[model samples]
Target chain A: MSATQTNDAPPEPGSHRRGLLWDGMLPEALGLCLVAIIFGGLAAGYLVTDYSWKQQSAAAHKAETEAVAQAMATALGCVADADGRSRAGEAPDVAAGPRTGRPSEQVELLMRELGRLPGLRSMHWTREGEAPAEPYREGEAPAEPYWEGEAPAEPRRDCSMVVTVAVRTLGGEPAGELRVERSASADAGYRSLLLWNWGTPTGITLLVFVALYRRLKRHLRPMVAIERNLHSCAQGLEQELQTLTLSDSLGRAAQGWNHLIEQLTQLHQRLQEAQGAEQADVMARFEGAVFRRVVDRLPIGVICVTNSHTISYANASAAALLQRGPDELVGRAVDKAIENPAVMQAVVAAQARSGAGLSVDHTSRDGDQETTLRFRILPVSAQSPSGDALITVEDISQLREGERARDNFLYHVTHELRTPLTNISAYVETLTQPGFDDEQTRKECYNVIVSETKRLSSLIENILTVSQLEVGTARLDVGEVDLTRLVRQMVQDNLAAADEKRIDLTLSLPPKVPKMRGDKQRLCILLNNLIGNAVKYTPAGGQVQVNLEVAENRLVLAVSDTGIGIAAEDQAQVFDKFYRATADAVQAVPGTGLGLALAREVARLHGGEIHLESELGQGSTFTIELPWPTSDQKVTR
Target chain B: MSRILVAEDDPHILRLISMWLKRQGHDVLEARHGLAARDLLQAEPVDVLISDINMPGLDGLELIEAVVPAGLVRRGVVVLTNRWDHGEIRTRLAAWGVHVLPKPFSPSRLSELIESLTSSDVTEPQA
Candidate 1:
């Protein structure tokens, strides 16, 4: 069967054939047809045999009647003549006399003489008109052969024969018919032979039909078992096709189909395994790539360690910060990295506080350079049954520096403001006293108070601005501005302060100073602060010069002054908040130390840097570098 | 007259405490930082010592530690700070019989603490 037809029924074990004999309509129809054919053949044979026997019996009976009728006619003629001779006074033939011989004997004698025989059991023979010798005396006629009237009548017997003729003695005239009687033993013998022959064959045919039915059933037993097995397979039961072993082609076909099914199932299983393996490979690659990139790109130092305290992984930042290579760090115990007892105590404490996961701040010293590190230990579990852990190390050295700087700034600013506040409060209190009510003294005190208020406001504003810039919250209103013009303007604005201190302020600009993209207000503020710092720090007779030069793709500005120079030790910390030079502190300069720090922050916001070059007693030079943008390269801020 | 050294950064607080002590007929010495207090203690023997904890360079805790060995502050040491979480201060000062008075202390409270320390039995080393 084709797949399309098999779709109508449930699928077979291996092929589209119906599993059971009765499962398909066609097989059932064929079985019914076969039964009908056998029964119809048997019925046809029975009808034919019955019809032939009836026809043969009828024909035989007609031929026997004809023969018997001819013999009876001869016998009756002989008897009638003998009786006529005796009645005509002539002596009757004694050998064939009717009165002395039985009718069967007389008929036989007559037939032998006449060459025709009569039926068997014919005892008495009488003429058609002859009466019994003992005639009926009113009601006493013989019961065996009685005559109702004196007339020529037909003879009656158990078996009888009759004869008729239309003739006169010498001329053609109607005469009485002569009849004879005989038994039918010959017909009975013939019927018995026909019955025996017909009955024997019928019995044999019935027996043969029964044997053939049993044989056919036995031969189809395997087919029935095959059907039952196929039904079980179709119903999702486990069918053992191996059990259907036969030395026939159908058994081989079944085995081949079963083999094909097993192969298909195996192929499906292998395909699933291949797909699963491919998916696992892709996931592993993806995870490895992601982990590698993240570890490499992290800015902070990181180190991972196993639960047994062996270092497993270290990033470049961690290696560099620790003053070692990544390979040297791997497989090393975490405690050996930094040998500070305090740091060790902190790590142990954090580990004790948070099992397997810890965050700690500790001070570490690498040779002469001391750094503060923040360590975070996170426990990671292994993918499989073998458990492991990953510990992460982060170096927060810069963060610690920034925090220290901020704390120092707060402490110094508070201290600086407190001095002025105390001075102002004291003066005001003194002025409020009854003895100090002079207008000149009062005006002087008011002036002092205003100046100090301005100083306090500027200090607060600078601190706030620097903090904003550090946190990346400060917005720059960037635009195209000429670097030389801005620097010259800053110098001009600070001319009075320089003149008061007797310092000569000069500006030098290249003829064609390039324009740069920057925040105009922020740049102006930065230049003013630098120039003002020069004027404030320089003593009398000091010279200050502002110069602008156009470098490649950038505009560089330099401000140099011959004033109180910063010491080498304080140069690095000059941009730090509230940091004053040791010399300047001795001189007691009247300026907040926040100017340089604020200037550095402004420069950083413009993606520029300020480089300071100075020596003791030889004024410092501050240089600012900014990127120059072409007309098309400028972006709106 | 007992010469008492008061090492306090705030001048207002110094003046108020000094005025109150002078009114009570005691000689009062004022210093703004730990260095000044050290200088003053070296010059004169103070009968009592009063100091603030948070100061530049050397704080009150270091001053207390320095004064005991120097034998300059002969009576009792009074430590003052604005910080309430002074468990470390208290613990470190316990051996020296140093009294930790939390800041925002009134002038009367200072006088009372000093009187209590001076008037008590000297053998107990009042803190």
Candidate 2:
């Protein structure tokens, strides 16, 4: 019927306060019963009091009337005794007169006094068989209906009481009858019942009920406050109960709520205080989740091994570096993860050493493929009895190759200087020997000595040139040189050498080749190298041709010779300093290996590149392409 | 007379070596470069080898690898080089039956080294 009734089933089996009986109607029934009890009590009590008042008043009226009548008889006897003890019927009748003649008057006076009783209507006397002794007194009887010829059967039947008695002489003889009458209704008793029992007690009970209900409502205020606070808490918003300053049972209930909230607040604080420790645990969980992914992305290969060299973990980097899957590297022996003896031994040695950090350079073989690596090992969780060691590998193959190239370059520089000097000394010493030479041999020895000196100087010069090119210190002497004239001059100088070898060295010029704008001496060196290599590498009866053409806004100088062409394998390295072809013609030819390297450097200095095309046992064509200069050129005499 | 092999990249040095060795009463073979020297060693069993370290193709180490591995050149090897960093290689070469002759060595010095290397009493037969 109400919202409260929705959950007002009998409390759960173990709950406090069972549901109210008759759907919580017992209190209402009790209230109704109380009202009925008060009403019934008042009504019944009013009726009983009214009824008893009537009965008792009537009985009292009858008793008082009888007593008065008896007293009248005794007075009549005394009057008779005084008149010589008159007998019952012999007594002087009060209707006649007493012997003393004052007795009649006295009887009248006594009758009037007896009529003074409350609710008394009349008092009278009569002779035995005669009429009344006197006429009725004024205001005595009003012709009452209750005074019938027969007596009333029940007290409620009449509202009046009448009593009669016979007078007796001193000898105890009956004389005259005496009678008294009074009304039985007591109105004052009815007024007392209404004021005392019915009205007053009902007003007091009503006042008590109102006070009780008001007190109950006051008690409920604290309960409402507590419920409001508890509802907030149930909604996940915490609020402490306000302390009640009362000293009643409701106050006790408020105190209980305040104590409960205080306890809850303390508990919440204890939970909040544990947050920092919980944060560390949460962070550790996060790291555990992402650790593998982060490590897999690292550039260097990383492997983790236990103290016993058991491979515990490997990231993707380690897996790829070792040519295996990340999962495949796990749970194997650390030595098996890397089979290179040097690297394996280095890891073992690093682990065997005590400190946390260790590093070693190792060369590992992937089958026939050798790779240089740098290994760095770190021991994690070192405080634990059996800690894991982290091994990282960085490939240093490029760095090692660079160092090897540097060492080879130094060796070449030294050898180029030393070879000619060795020959010079040997030739000079040979020429000085006593009788050691025929004139012809003597002349050849002197010639060898002079040429060795020139070779030594030229070797020094080439070294200086190579060094200058490497360090970017070579400066160009800018000038203009006619390509037609320069080519003819270079060709003429090489013609003698070509004739000695019987090579048909020829020069071709397009009608309009662009005049070159660059350092004259460097250009001469570049041209001399190109033409000289052609002449030197060509066998007897082979042809060497040089051509200069302008094409696509650039000058292309091409030298083609029927020389021993470069092998496919050696073509890439042919331009390196001190490189010489292994072909028979190139080996037999007497020229420093620096020629092609120097020529390319000179071409590069002029903002061009040299392109070579050749097949083994065929001929090579060297083409130099330079962008044409747009500005005016200077001509030197 | 023991046969000696001389391999050098420079023609003048090669000639100078050949002439001096001829004066020392030893038959000498001349090679212009490492490839030529490797061919000469392949053709005959020379007693001693005088080789240069720096050559155009198939340099001194390559020649040594060819000859020494086959137990050719029985009278031991003489490595001639102008390289200053050849000490480590020279030590390895000497260990493997080769001797070092730095470049600029005089003909007189060359004769002395040849005398000592060819003299059987003072040398171990290169194994």
Candidate 3:
């Protein structure tokens, strides 16, 4: 499911987004189209209303201009008639007052009446061909109808109209010409009204569009979040299913999606639990956390590699054995972690679940320390999702060393046993033969045979005891040991051997000796071995001392021999089973080399330890220390 | 009588070999270890050298190693060892034309080998 989702899901939701509504492209496009249509309609309405306003304002302006011209023409006609009557010697009656029949007075009266018309700038009358009729003016004089100081309050240059009207007499005959100029300031009010007409509707349409977009954005927010989250889930970018929930504010569709996601999460959890149960069933003894803990704490290394050829899990021991950091081996290629081709092939075979498991030993050297590791590669059952191949590594250097030691022990034992066997065989064969059978020679042969047989039996016995002690199969005859008596008896047993070499063999004991709880026979064997070795190794006239001291709640028995001592290099390994020193002095004496090892083992069984102190050509001492049992604790099991 | 040297660490084996060789009317020389045997050979070369492999001071192999090239023994060298598992040492001894006898061997067999050595003029075994 995750793979399919990852392959099918588009690049996350927010990338390359085109604005706030990018996620809902269809709605955004639709909203944009509607806004564009509304804006286009408002613009068209504005253009038409502007055109109509322009036409009405233009017509009203033309009418106002024509009316001012007509009023000026009528006033000029009255003035012209009055002037003509005065020229013809007749009195011209005027509405304001009686005329004096002077043309200037009549023109003054005409200026006053026409200037009162709101738009009239100035009026000029020409009689027949009179010299411009003095260019009749409104303010003070007719100077282009604009006074220098009072320029008609800054009138627009294009807002003025010029009208020429030919005046006629009262009988409708042409009398004089009248030219009138009027300011068209009244048209500015109409133009402002047109702007107001266009602006109000456009602003209202834009306001409505913005309000709708904001509302749509509020509704789309939850939807975009849900979409992005779904894409993330499909891509397997989110591990936590609960974090993919949509807000309840997003209505029923979102609530339904969240409910489906919740169910999916629960199903995933159940599947994992089922897998865990299967794994537990397969591993009958250990399950889940307990299995993990056991594997981690095991002395052997365990590495689990998935079918993908990568390590999925490596226990702590595995990491330590691999000499890597705790997490270094995990997620690395199996071949890379295990450099041996045989081991890698075994791992591959295990992962394939073919053939029986293969085990290989790999030897590596780091400086002076050489290590032998045994790798056992086994296949995990198919039900486990965690791993396909399980590789276990055990450091078998010590085990191999033990095997070598055992082989050496056998070789030495056989060699030592064969010496007496050869003697017994040669002597027995000589006895069977009838040549030169002197009684003296026969007596000698019988004695040699008997003694060789005894030597052979003793060697065999020592080998068995040492083997039993080493393998921990020897049953201890536990008893309260009288150290003083045991020491005396052991020393007494070795006195003859010491006396043969003319060595001074002595024993020293403290005033009080504490009894110890231990194996009596093994203790006797231990003391006899030490004391006998001292006597055997000491040269003629050398001293052999057995001292028993009880101090610091412990018993220390030390046997010091003034003889050819052990070399420093061989001292450490002297107690190892069947390890006879190759030194000439050590080899000069006949020994099976199991004495000290057996002695040490016996001491250990009694909760004691043996220590060796020796110098070449100087004397040697073997010290056995045991915890002095208290009076009440002397009870033996 | 041919002179024969018996080098052994064990007293009983040494005495038995000496007694057998002496009974055969062969002049027998005895040494407890390889070093003493080597000293005896250095003083006067023997016709046959019967040696044990394990000894103090120097081992039988080392003694033979020192003696064979120097012609310390006239006719043959015999090795008595219990280390049957030492294949490498055995191979080396074979290459040196030395005879090996594992321990607990027959006394009659040993007597036959010494008799052949004393009777033959050949210093090397026939291929």
> In angstroms, how far off is A477's CA in candidate 2?
6.0
Docking outcome class, model 1? incorrect
Interface RMSD of 1: 7.7
Instruction: Order the candidates by lDDT, highest first.
Output: 3, 2, 1
The residue pairs that clash in candidate 2, if any, are: A88-A173, A88-A174
Candidate 1 per-residue lDDT, tens place, A139-212, comes to: 55333221222222332212333333321222222224433333332345444544555555556655676686
Candidate 3 C-alpha lDDT tens digits along A332-398: 9988998888988888787676558899899999999889999999866767766578889999999
lDDT by residue (tens digit), candidate 2, A20-137:
2223664587599679867976886677666666666667667776776687677766564554434344555444334543555555555555545655565555555665644443
Could you give the C-alpha RMSD of every candidate to the true structure, in order shown?
16.5, 16.9, 21.8
Q: How close is candidate 3 at the interface, in terms of C-alpha RMSD after superposing the true interface residues?
A: 1.0
Between candidates 1 and 2, the one scoring higher on lDDT is: 2
TM-score of chain B of each: 0.90, 0.90, 0.93
Per-residue alpha-carbon lDDT of candidate 3 for residues B1-127, written as tens digits (9 for 90 to 100)? 8999999988888888888888889999999998999999999999999998889998988998999789898888888887875466668777567887888887789989888888877766622
Candidate 1, clashing residue pairs?
A: A103-A123, A128-A152, A159-A182, A160-A182, A167-A173, A168-A173, A305-A391
Please report, as a value between 0 and 1, the fraction of native contacts recovered by candidate 1. Answer: 0.00
Judge candidate 3 at residue A174 and give its lDDT: 76
- The local lDDT score (0 to 100) that residue A348 gets in candidate 3 is 79
